[model samples]
Target: MEKEKIDAAQESSPGITRRGFLQTVGIGTLEIAVVGAVAPAVQAETRQRGNLVPLTLKVNGQRHELHVEPRWTLLYVLREKLELTGTKPGCDRGECGACTVLIDDRPRYSCLTLALEADGHEITTVEGLMHGEQLGPVQEAFVQEDGFQCGFCTPGQVVAAEGLLRHTANPDIGEIRTGMSGNLCRCGAYGHIFKAVQRAAILRK
Candidate 1:
């Protein structure tokens, strides 16, 4: 009798089996669990996007008023929002100086700096070093002295040199090395970079 009833049920549900039903239920539960776990995170990100803070940044001799998320990095704002692509994003952490920018004439890693923190402060990127159509002295020196090989780190190196020269005017070989120590060149162009800094100092004077 029981066998007859099981056969009748299987015939009624055409291709459906006990295992298939269990599999469907398991998948449905897993999907519900996944959605439950992901919904809160998505909602939180939406809230964060909605809560943008107003920011005022003075960059490259210009003042800009904009809205930014508190978590946005200065590097992101410069490259993504302001369309300044000169500052390279190298490591993204503070260890690499490829994202170096001038904050009040001092070198700071833009990747590590929060956009909110730079509010109402003077920020200078590699683009800021240009004089209208001509390259700045440090950039010209870098070109003439062949201060870079791959040129990936050249912008940061030039900015760092500018900051160094701002305070020291004429740094000795040792002082140049010390001042530029924060920046790294993967192409092994230290000698030319140092010469470039020296040349930039002369050009600046």
Candidate 2:
């Protein structure tokens, strides 16, 4: 009975064998090897790019200076750096005008435009269209006419309409369609949007 009890105690206590030691060492070595292999690649990538270049953007009547990566798009800088998130990224392929911003009074696709490219240019985002806490005519018309349904594309649509009005004030229905062709409304609010532009024109007059 004494010998049986001693054997049971020995079984209950976990004692590492040579096989277990070897297995532990093997796992540790594999982990070390993985780290050694991956760390250099990560370090190499970190060393590769993202060198800061001087960027000066005149945004919303304010000039801003910053150091940014060469590959950063204007949309990224506008949204991430400047915190102008009114511009939405819908398609990101420039097919959708959701990232529209007025560059020198013309609607530009910020996703396709590089930060460096937008440097030294006047950039007008949706946030700039207000007059001392009052919304611009385009924005007001959009609200009054119920131009937007989802409001995701409203910023671009409003900017595009503003730009169109600058070029063709008091435009007819066909002219409005041709002018606002760049901006796409997924909410099917094109009819209301057209009326909004017309209302904005009348307000301007």
Candidate 3:
């Protein structure tokens, strides 16, 4: 009698087997769980986007007051907003020193630094290392020593060299290598780069 009732229900609901019904229920439950897990994250991101905060950044001796998202990186603000393309975006991670900049006279990876974290700090880029129409000593040294090839990484290299020299006015060959170890030259321009740092030291003196 029970089997007959079960068969009758199956016949009434054509194409709906027990297994198919269970599968549908299982899929629906999984989808609900996924939505429940993802909805909060999506809503939080939306809220963050809606809440833009005011930021004050001191760049290359100029002060900029602007609104920026909390998640924005210093690299993006520099290159995209301020049009300081001298800070190259390489690897978009700390691994590549192509986005190096000076924060409080220390070398920092701009790509890894948050725009908010740099608030009220002295920031310097390759473009700031100029005097009117003349290149800074480090930039001139790079040119005179032929320290770059392709020139994509030249900006970061120059900034890093400048920061290195700020603390150590005269770095020996070993100190130069160690100071510049964080920056890389894909063109294998280490020899020229080292020479450039030495030349920059002399020029600064």
Candidate 4:
């Protein structure tokens, strides 16, 4: 009986089956790798949460105060915390310019801009361009020229165009192209967008 039991135990051992052995090893390796990758990020994120600082922003002439993690971006604060959703996060890396907002009267990519960096600066969003239910000329021109198709990029385009027109009262074609170059319309509305810029300049004057 003892010999028969020993033979059964050896035959049914976990290491006896190659597939089961490999699976156990693979699961252990994956767990170690996942821990290695996630532990550091969790530690850093916890540290950031512990160091949440007070941030004040003058957005669209309104003052906002909040305690934000150091790692939070301006776009996240604007859209998530402040409920200002006009700024789109098309490319969070600042390449698409879809999350553009006016920082101290200059167009800046909000996603790439940290909320702490925007402190004490005058921040303007697309919502700032309105006059108590009246649209600014830049927005009006965009609508008149049908400057978009899906309208996802319109807010950023309008904000960027408004910034450009503010600096150059009458930007020529070359200047218009250069100034508006940072913004992109995925709908291929470049022609109408160009016309809108020209018309916005005229309207502003």
- What's the TM-score of each model vs. the native? 0.79, 0.77, 0.77, 0.77
Model 3 ranges with Cα > 4 A deviation? 1-49
Instruction: Write model 2 residue lDDT over 73-136, tens digit each, in one string.
Output: 9999998788788888989989989999999999999999999999778999999988879999
List ranges where model 2 is wrong by over 4 Å: 1-45, 48-50
lDDT of 3 at 105: 99
Candidate rank order under TM-score: 1, 2, 4, 3
lDDT of 4 by residue, 50-143 (tens): 9999989899999998999988999999987887888999978988778999998899999999999999999999999988899988999999
lDDT of 1 by residue, 1-205 (tens): 9999999998888597665687689889977876878987678779988989999989999998889999999999998788788999999988869999999999999999999999878999999999998999999999999999999999999999999998999899999999999899999999999999999999987
lDDT of 3 by residue, 1-205 (tens): 9999999998887687665687689889977876878987678768987988999999999999988898889999998789788899998989879999999999999999999999999999999999889999999999999999989889999999999999999899999999999898899999999999999999877
TM-score of 3: 0.77
- Better candidate by lDDT, 1 or 2: 1
> At residue 51, what lDDT does model 1 achieve?
89
Q: Over 4 Å off in model 4, which ranges?
A: 1-46
In model 3, which residue pairs have backbone atoms overlapping below 3 Å?
A: none
lDDT of 1 at 33: 74
lDDT against the true structure, per candidate, is: 0.92, 0.89, 0.92, 0.89
